[model samples]
Target chain A: MNPNTAWLRKTVALVILIGVWEACADLGYFDPLYMPAPSKVAVALFQLFAQGTIWPHLIATFSAALGGLVVGLVVGTVLGAVAALTPLVGELLAPVMISLNAVPRVVLAPLFVIWFGIGVGSKVALAFILVAVLIFFTVFTGIRDVDRRLVERVITLGGGRGALLREVYGPSVIAWILGNLKVAVGFAFTGAVVGEFVAATKGLGYLLSFAQSSYNAALMLALVVLIMGFVLLLFGLTGLLERRLLRWRG
Target chain B: MLRVDSLALAYGATPVLEGASLEVPSGKFVSLVGPSGSGKSSLLRAVIGLQQPLAGVIETDIGAGDIGMLFQDDALLPWRTAEQNVALGLKLKGVAAGTAIASARQWITRLGLYGLSERFPRELSGGQRKRVALAQVLAREPQLILMDEPFASLDAIVRARVTQDLVRLVELRGISVLLVTHDLEEALALSDVVYLLSHGPRARISGRYEVNLPRPRDVIKARSHPDFAPLLQRLWNDLSREVGERAA
Candidate 1:
């Protein structure tokens, strides 16, 4: 639990991962044509960056991911808040959400492609479908977990419905919402990449699919890492905002 | 006057208060003293309309002035400033923004929190939070008040100070209170009358004693008051005896 120990522990994990990858590559258990070495992946990333191919794919995927995140956040928050406060709506929507969650969103990609075309719109739409449910479940559980004791305390002070929501439930649920926002963004990013892979004219996922068709294994790995890096950047920024929201908790 | 008549209260199916009746006149600070699970809190909850009395009449005659209830932890909104939390009740009653907020705010200053208005609940200490809650309640200018062990969470010194401030505030506002507490000295120190509740499947008022001690009374000095020790000893003995009798 010590701060210094945690830093060292993370360093050890990174070293171990790289060490294992290098050892596997040196052993030649797998052919380099099928599985590129990490150094080759790094070289492919540098080559893509030099040719200015990485930036366009980065921009394409980032747009889809960010758009999906925004739509998911707004719609999910509205649904979650409404569902938590109103039992009838909650009961009606609960089953529908479960079914939606169960359905493979990839199966709907072709439908989205037909509806929105093979552009960013189709990708964004597909991502939204995937991300919205993650946000809904997290935020709903957040509101549900609010302390009943605190609500009673507010009510006994003669707080009306709106006041109880504002003072008791809203503040109480912020920690949950923010905690889930990070994971929700990750889900949204995953949805975006999956959408791009299914049918996309451009994006890191498209680049990945294109590289695999050409048997450019290192380029595919580079594109995969780049997408993960983009996800991490957005995720890190959200975490910063989360820390601000929870400063009151400290 | 507050009338709790023929009250039958319960937590789910298990009954707690069976045919309980008590009358609290306006402008008196009364304490309900009891052992644990004696329906003191349940009675307070029933009075506040938070818990239904199952089958009884809890009548409130005065309806004009705003009412306030204070809990042990103060329960201030962590995101709100001291002044904003204090003025929340005014906002809740659909009070006009300009006038209600302006009038509601002067109390924080009057109650020694003049410049600390913008500080959030997390920034304040335990004693300061209690003061904020007190200011919050006082800002309502309630004719009737209810407290569920408001000062029980404070240390002895802070409790004494807050209790003193409370007595002064009550006198200034002429607020009628029905307080629930397990602290006998606290009950004796602040109450004009004390009602003792005994524990059971159906808890009832075991004894009612008039606290003849003069205000503004302090607990340290209360023990030395001519009637204090005897009253304390009597309540203590009765409560112990009741518990023992029940155990047997």
Candidate 2:
């Protein structure tokens, strides 16, 4: 469990896997047309970046994902707070939200394309739906789950409605939202890519579809690696924010 | 000053207290001691406006804002720092940020938690968290304070020390306190007047004893006082009889 040894073990495992993969491809264990070696994928990744062919797709995807995340967070927080604080609203909305959540959100991508057209708008809308549902449930439950004792303490201190929200429910909800940011990020990305796959002029998902049509396995795997990198970067940023905001949990 | 008369408290049809009454005079420490499930906490809750008394008259010269309460569980906000927790009441009262911070700092320092102002409740020990809770209540500068077994969770030595510090602070500020606890010795050590409540179905004030002990009494050493044993024995006799009767 030593940090250094853990890091070394992970590195060795990855290296061995890639070595075996390269050996199999070089020995022609599989057709290169369908399965490219790790080296070919790496070269394709380098060329895609060096030739700047990936910039537009990357930017399109990033913008759509970021936009959806922001919109979802804001709208979900408002709805969740309303649902938690008002019983009538919760009674009216809870079942509707549950039904929406039960449906496979990905299936909505084609309908969204038909509604919003094959552009960033459709992708943004899809991502918004995905992230909003997640954040709504989390914030709603978090607010409701705030310790009643803490609320009573605040009221005894002469705190009013605003104070209850600010001091008691606000921090609790924020903590819950931050705790689930990793999942939210992944869902947002999935929403954007799925929307693009159904219909889009530009984006990593569009490029992936194009690569599939051409049967260029190296390019397809290269795009897959690129998407993973983007998701990882977002995940890392969210982690940093989580640590800073939840330092009290230490 | 707080006065409750002919108080009847119940949850739905189940009666918890009936004809329970007590008074906390200005600048006096009063304790309510009783067996468990004797409706002590219910009375405190009714007084604090967290619950409604089925029928009672609670008269107080102080406004709700001028009264502070300490919960049995400390109830410190887990996400806020010690200083921020103390500053909460001030902020709620519309005190300026700078003044609230300054006052919070002073209270934290006075409670011997100066360097720990930035620590969260989870990062603090049980004793340290209790001190922070005390600081939080004291910082509000309430004319009257209500405590529901605030130090019940601490060890004997820590509880004694906290009680001493609390007494000194309340005395210095001339704040009246109404404390509820099951610990007979704690009640006798800290209060000028102790009211013992009988066991429930309809708990009522069964007896009252005045501790003629002087002010600034050392709660730890006060037990060894010549007058301490007899008062303790008398209260215990009344309380144990109620408990035994209830068990039967």
TM-score of each: 0.88, 0.97
Which one is best on TM-score? Answer: 2
lDDT of 2 by residue, A1-250 (tens): 7986997999999999999999999999978999999999999999998999889999999888888999999988899999999999999988988988999888999999889999899999999999999998998899889999999989998898988998989999999999999998998899988888889999999998999999999999999999999899989999999999999997
Model 1 residue runs over 4 Å out of place are A1-40, A102-117, B94-106, B109-116
Assess the local accuracy of residue B9 in candidate 1 as a C-alpha lDDT between 0 and 100.
Answer: 84
lDDT of each: 0.81, 0.92
Among incorrect, acceptable, medium and high, the docking class of model 1 is: acceptable
Considering just chain B, what TM-score does every model have? 0.94, 0.97
Best prediction by DockQ: 2
iRMSD values, candidates in order? 2.6, 0.8
Candidate 2 Cα errors over 4 Å, as ranges: none
- Quote the positional error of residue A177 for candidate 1 in Å: 2.3
Candidate 1 local lDDT, A124-185, one digit each (tens): 88778777887777767778887776687578666778877778877766677788888878
lDDT of 1 by residue, B1-100 (tens): 7888878888888989887778778888889988888888888887877787788888888663466778767877777788787777676666776665
Worst 10 residues of 2 chain A by lDDT: A1-10
Candidate 2 per-residue lDDT, tens place, B30-72, comes to 9999988889999999999998998879999998888999988
Q: What's every prediction's RMSD, in angstroms? A: 3.2, 1.4
